[model samples]
Target: MLTSSTFSYAIGLILQSIAARRTITSNSIERGLVIRLATDRCYAWGLAAQVAGFLLAFYARETLPVYLVQAAACAAVGVAAVMGAVAFGWRVTRAEAAVLAVLTVALVLLAGAAEPSRVTAVPPATGWVLTALLASCLALAPAAWRARGAVPLAGLAGAAFAVLAVASRPLPALDVTALPLQPLAWLTLAAAAVGQILLAAALQRGSTTSAGSAMDAVTMVAASAAGLALVGDRIADGRTAWLVVGLILVVAGVLAMARVGTVVGEPIRHTDNDVADQPITQGNAR
Candidate 1:
């Protein structure tokens, strides 16, 4: 389920990136508008993919430890990075490749060290925590919007996603008939939507490598903490040290991926009138 979700997310991102590039290059006014429409459509598809991924992930969290599920999902970053390199022509340095490889190993270790999640009914306090998290993300959105860099926006998005992950812990089993009746389910959906919007905005504002890394790192830490505190998730017997080491490596690798520069083929060229709206930046190039 996690693997399938990651593939869906990668495909969605690639489509959205392609559409964004098309929107920038259309020669005729009508053609530009059409391209813009297509870009929006692509974004919708991306959103759908993300929503589906989150649902599957949330459902899995019921049985799997949070760190394990999250680690598996965060692997989507690698998929996105590779797609960006191949589809958008972003060049990955050898160092970036090395870091990604380390990240993969760390995920494996984290998963191996995770004990099964404690399955229990949702506690009342869980609702309050989810509300607070949602409110915090809302408060940060405006500030992230005003920031010049993608890190703030990406971080906010990651945090919002963490909230969704936490909320998902108590979610009633996914049922077409009963899910809509649950308030927590609605809250989870709202949080996912907000996270996706913020992430997309962040990606538009800067390099995917940077934005994706920030999102993944923040989500891993935040979600793991929430899982431990709110859902009583624990490491496998005598595996605390392993979990800690794996987490450190995961964070280090994510930061390394963020710092590595990406070089895309045929730089996105913008017309004079479109210059201010041009989203690509040289900062993304090493």
Candidate 2:
């Protein structure tokens, strides 16, 4: 089932987290830092997982509402934290444990409350608005990075991903041969590139809690509203109150662990000799 894509999302985030954690920081400028992360040997695995998550999300959107899908996206961070504990020996604090539980309840409520609907026609202006949204993300990225704070940069990353979702919304219905002519398809590719870069940058320089929470907050909430108003996403009869409750719990869950931080215990950077002798693999490629 597509609900299983949540696990794929989690695994991808975990791999990407590992890549971001082990990144070498010395002598790298801001732009250079992003490039380094993108090209890091570990990031190749992360990128592959990200591609998987992207495809899974595309399929899942066919049957689920954007709000629910983005909630799963947000919850994927908690799942990654749990994976880190199990696979990487990272310790989980009490607060993180609590957030995980809250996420579980929120997801259940969201899933039960959602009534998936086919979007027959999107207004012409809506598609163009998404294109414009991607453009704004590109134009504002430098200034956003200059702001140097997690909320601004991560928030921008979230907005960019929202564009990715909206652009993807109508694509499942389009003919394969028509994709080249579809503005939404082109926008999807651009949004994915911009969103991936900004998200990696946010995760690398900022706290996991802040980056994940802030980024998903914007995407889950904003994209949900956009889905309802623009893309015809819906709630089941008598499920509105439950949906609201679920979202409130998600808010409470994120707020509970709100603190300044980054992922911990990065391994030491290897010597130049070690780098020169390392064997290359698919993980080494972008």
> lDDT: which candidate is best?
2
Model 2 steric clash total: 1
Give candidate 2 regions above 4 Å deviation: 21-29, 255-286
Residues 221-284 of candidate 2 have per-residue lDDT tens digits of: 7788788888888999999998898877776665454441222322323444334332222122
lDDT of each: 0.69, 0.71
Cα-based lDDT at residue 52, candidate 1: 72
Model 1, span 247-271: residue lDDT tens: 8888778778777745222355444
Worst 10 residues of 1 by lDDT: 22-31
Query: Each prediction's TM-score against the native?
Result: 0.82, 0.85
lDDT of 2: 0.71
